[model samples]
Target chain A: MSVLDKIYEKAKANPQKVAFPEAENEKMMQAAYETGKEGYIKPILVGDSTRIKELIAERGYEESVFEIIDIAEESYKNDVVARYVALPHTMLKEKAIGRRMENPLYYAMAMQAVGDADVTFAGIDNTTGDVLLAGQMIIGLKEGISTVSSIGLCDIPGFEGSEGQLLAVGDSAVCTNPTPEQLADIAISACDTVKGLLDWEPRCAMVCYSTLGSGQGELIDKVKEALAIANEKRPDLDIDGEFQLDAAIVPAVAAKKVNRESKVAGKANVLIWPDLNVGNTAVKLIQQFGHADAYGPMLQGFNSIVCDCSRGAPVSEIKGNVVISAVRAMGQK
Target chain B: MERKELEAQIIKMVAQCYNADEAKLSVDSVFGEDISGTSVMMVGLVSEIENELDAMIQLSDAAACKTIGDLVDKVEEEL
Candidate 1:
């Protein structure tokens, strides 16, 4: 099965409440409809209730197939505001709370924070910053996680390093230039996500411009330090790095480059890039030139399961994200 | 580090973060209002400060700070 197919199977079996804050968008609404129809998730659409109902009717879909949360409704607004006020010393104070409640995305997140929803899938009509800020201020980060990072699940044909065709490339959509500690956190977050969604023992390669002690520079040092920190923090996982892309995924390169025998040397399924520029560029290059399919820019390190879809993503991509987000929510449960 | 030294470092960091002049960024300069710090910039600032002080600063505490001095005070408190 494809990774998404497996995730769809798992999600369909134990469906979770996944909220789509950009429910007003045509693509998002259609994806939500499909997600609910396939039993992959129970989609909660957060937008104008009447308009959403009209759209459902217009689209020939059952209104009961999706639950709509209208932020404009006085009662629902009051409930979200009340929930925001009740959180233990919430960061969203009076001024922030007023501003946040006006945005449906934050309201949707507030619902997740208060257990009214399970997960939030958004960013269709909003910037990544908006989605991330709402998530951080409302749902907050998981315990001991100080930073929020993202991972792109790449399915590259002819890429034989990983167990399947999938590889997790991280800090692609966040963390422009991560410090060593933050890089370590990104690795751990990616590992947790891979294990949860794909059910694989993540072998991470902290990719950089250098491989082992082959080169020396500030960038290489940063990757090396990150590797040490990740190793010290999680001894159970197989992770190594300061590896060049070739050394990371090709067994021949791994055998020639370093003396130490490493499980993740050539078999790394999770490639933690040194910076956002490198990660983002590499993934896009692969997608364009190599004809690989990249599934996510999945937000990680949050206490709750929240995923962001590119604003230009199609209905199929949105549906895939809902299933992936549902699978993550199931893992969390 | 002395409080003044730490304060200087923070002003420089915040100024760099906002792409403003260091001389204009006083200790009382609010991060979001006076200095224009975004959530992404805040994360970078927290990392920079932590590395400088060799101490952990809670993001919640940092987010609560209204000014550079408030951040310095939190760092002092942590120390």
Candidate 2:
């Protein structure tokens, strides 16, 4: 079965409560309807009630299936939201100040903060900054967390030699060019996420254009430093880098080229790029040109649960994203 | 700073980072051409601009920075 199938089964068994904040959007409302029908999650649709009803009728789905929180009317939304925040005065005041907190994205986050929902996903109509800030400010980054990054969970279907590979390419959506320390944190966080969400033992490769001392540059040095730090802290992990992409993934290629007897060599399922550009571009390339399936650009390192999807994503993509985000919310890794 | 001065600074930074001639930079300088900061360099430039200007410039902002003048206007607006 596919990864989504497994997750959907797991989620269905537990039937965790999840939220779709931008439920007012036509596509999101449609997705919520499907999610409800599937019985994997109890979805809270946060937006204007009338708009949601219109969308439900528009999609030809039953409106009684999902719960809706109407934020169109200030007094009503404020009354409901105010009860949740400890600083009710401040939240109430803010509700009165702005145009219903811009959209349900913020209000939805506030809901998650107060345990109204187990996981929240948005960004179809929001920017990364908007999603990140709402998450950081309202949800807040976790203690000991510095920045948020993304991981792509690619489920390649039965490539003759390799059956299942769950790889992570990161610092893609968040940090620009992380400091060496930040890179170490990213590696550790990604390793944990991979182990938790995908159940794959991490064979981490810190990738670059160069392979194992073949190249000389500052970028190479950064990758080397990060690998060293990550290994020192989590010595049990098979993490090594300053290697090229090909050597990292293919065991025979890595054995011949990298000259390292390390287990991670040629067996890397988690690839941590030197920077955001490499990580972001590499994943997109894999998805676009290589025909490899991709999931996420899911945010990591937040205190409470907050995740973002692409503004251009379809409902299935968002559904896949929710699986990853919900796994994160469960505090697995 | 006058908009032109900021423009000049942007041109200088792009020229240095992208290894292109300063003369190629203009208000409409698209990054990938006439000098380009690979993704790494773009992030670095964003940091530099933020540090120099004490503003919080985002990567999304960098996506629109095509030319020397384009970066200058962005920097000026943020400043």
Candidate 3:
């Protein structure tokens, strides 16, 4: 089965509660409705409850299919805010928390923070900035993760590599150019993400223009440091690197180029690009020229499963993402 | 360096990091909206300023900087 099929199967087997902060958004609602209908996820639509119910009813769907959190309701809003403030290390006054809770995005994050929801999904109407800020302030980053990043899957049409035709790439959508520390975090997050989403024993390669000592530059140094940091932090994970694309995924090239014992060099199922430039361009090339289907850029490194989809993404892609997020939430919680 | 020159230098550095139009940048440019990728760019700026000025910059302090002015203020305090 395909990665999406496998993930969807997992999602179907254990549908997690995915809270949509932008519940009223057309594409988001459609995707949530479809995912909920398919039993891949239990959608918790957070926004104007009346309108949400109207949308559900208009679509010939049962209102019983969704659990709508009426952001408009005064008592429920106050209760969420109260619960958020009462969480350990909130550091925000009740009034301050209540004030920010006016935004549905913050409200959803607050819900996740206080266990009212499982996963917080957004980024259609809200900028990535708004989502990240809410996630940072409310849900907070995972312990030791300093920034939020993303991971995506690339299923190349004709090219077979590690993990079959499926390979995972990261930091393509959210971070612009990751620093060494952020890159390390991205690598670790990518490993965990694939493990959660694909159930693969992650062999991650930190990619660059060089493979070992074949080339040298400041950029190569950055990739090297990233691998070091990732290895130091999570020694159990098979995260290795400073490999070129060939060395990363091609066994022959890896044998010729990589002079050290590295589990990830040839058998890498996860390729962590050194920066967003490499990641974004690589994914585009694969999609346009290689005729591959790019799966994510799903946001990671948060305390909870947080996601950000492109505003222009279609409802089908959104459903796939929701399914991906649901399966991830299943593994995480 | 005087505060004026320091702010100007930081702004130019930030502009370089962002690859944004230097003419549009200012102390008031919000980190998230104006700069878009604050974590990476701000880390670069902090490291650049630290190396060029021989000043220590904490990444957490840099992360806390919400605006270009806030970053400049942090640099000044460090200096």
Candidate 4:
């Protein structure tokens, strides 16, 4: 079966009330139909209803399967803007009023805030910055969460019908140049996310251009400091840093190259990038050039749910993202 | 070096990294030009300038530096 089928099966069996904030697109309609048909989610659609109906008819999608929320008629977008304006605090209402962009992410976030939906995913039709700003402004960041991160589930097929193992790579999407504190939070948060998915404990490797303290600078120091902080906070977490790809993943190479005697040195499942450029570029390289299948740029460390998908994502990709987002909102991932 | 000289040096460094026509690569020359540098190459250019010039610049600053002229101007200010 395909990945979507697997996710669908999982969702069908799950008792959680999953919700998807749909757009005026075919992919969302497809997922809504499939999820609703399977009783996997009480799908929520938010967009231009006429466009959605046209697309649904064009795709032969069943309209009876999902609940559609049209913003133009009900002025749902205006309602959210109004609510933000009515807030007693002057600073917040002013800040909300200043956001001139009529992005749908704000509406989606408002849905989550009011318990109208359990989770929301959008970034296919909007820029990453727009989606993030809406979430930050409306839902706010989680407590003790100073920054946001995007982790990808890298699932590559192994040789001879072996079960494919997943690798979590992160801070590659949102943060351009994270501070030491932010890096530490990224590592810890990524580890927590990974622990929810896999049976294995997280062995985080703070990937760098240079391996194992060979490079000395603010960037390297940042990783080192974050590593120390991560180790200190989660003493049981197996996390190491300032290591290159080979040193982090290859047993013999790590043993020969680095002297750090830790569980994360050779077999790190979660790899944190030094910066967004490196992290984003490296993940794309692994996905496209290395022929690895990537699942997310799953936005974490937010109080409300918002996941970003590639602009060229397929139905399966959207479904998988929805599942992950739902699980994250439910505090499972 | 004078501010103009520093800007010129920054442009020269960027041109060398980018392998573009030095004259065409003025402070105002746009990055990602068809005959100019790609975002990837521009990143290298930024790194090279940083290391050689011993100056600190955020990637955001480098990204927002639209033209070679704009880049040199930034280099001058940062330096």
Minimum summed lDDT over a 10-residue window in model 4 chain A is located at A89-98
Give the TM-score of chain A in candidate 3: 0.95
Candidate 4 lDDT over A81-128, as tens digits, reads 566556442113423332322335656666665556777777677667
Clash pairs (backbone) in predicted model 1: none
Report the Cα lDDT for residue B76, model 2: 74
Q: Which lDDT tens digits does candidate 3 get at residues A170-244?
A: 878877788898899999988899898888999999888888867998999989998899999999999988889
How much is the lDDT of residue A174 in candidate 2?
78
Off by over 4 Å in 2: A72-102, A157-166, A232-237, A257-261, A331-333, B1-79
Best TM-score among the predictions, by candidate number: 3
Candidate 3 vs candidate 4, lDDT winner: 3
Taking all chains together, each candidate's TM-score versus the true structure is 0.80, 0.71, 0.81, 0.67
- Cα displacement (angstroms), candidate 1, residue A145, comes to 2.4
Candidate 3, superposed: residue stretches over 4 Å from native: B1-79
Clash pairs, candidate 3, are none
Show how many residue pairs clash in every candidate, following the order shown. 0, 9, 0, 3
Better of 3 and 4 by DockQ: 3
Per-residue lDDT value at A314 in model 1: 82
Per-residue lDDT over A1-333 for candidate 2, one digit per residue giving the tens place of the 0 to 100 score = 777777776666666567888887777776677777787667788887888888788778887878788767677556545654464212223332233255688678767766778777888888777787666545655454456666777655443222254456786667888877678768877877777666677788888878889898999899889888888877878888777988888877887887757777777878888898887787777777767787777677665567777878888877767766676666452
Output the lDDT of residue A283, model 1.
Answer: 93
Evaluated at residue A333, the lDDT of candidate 3 is: 74
Better of 1 and 2 by TM-score: 1
Whole-model alpha-carbon lDDT for candidate 1 = 0.83
Residue A177 CA displacement from its true place in model 1, Å = 1.2
Residue A236 in model 1: lDDT: 88
Q: How large an RMSD does model 1 have? A: 7.9
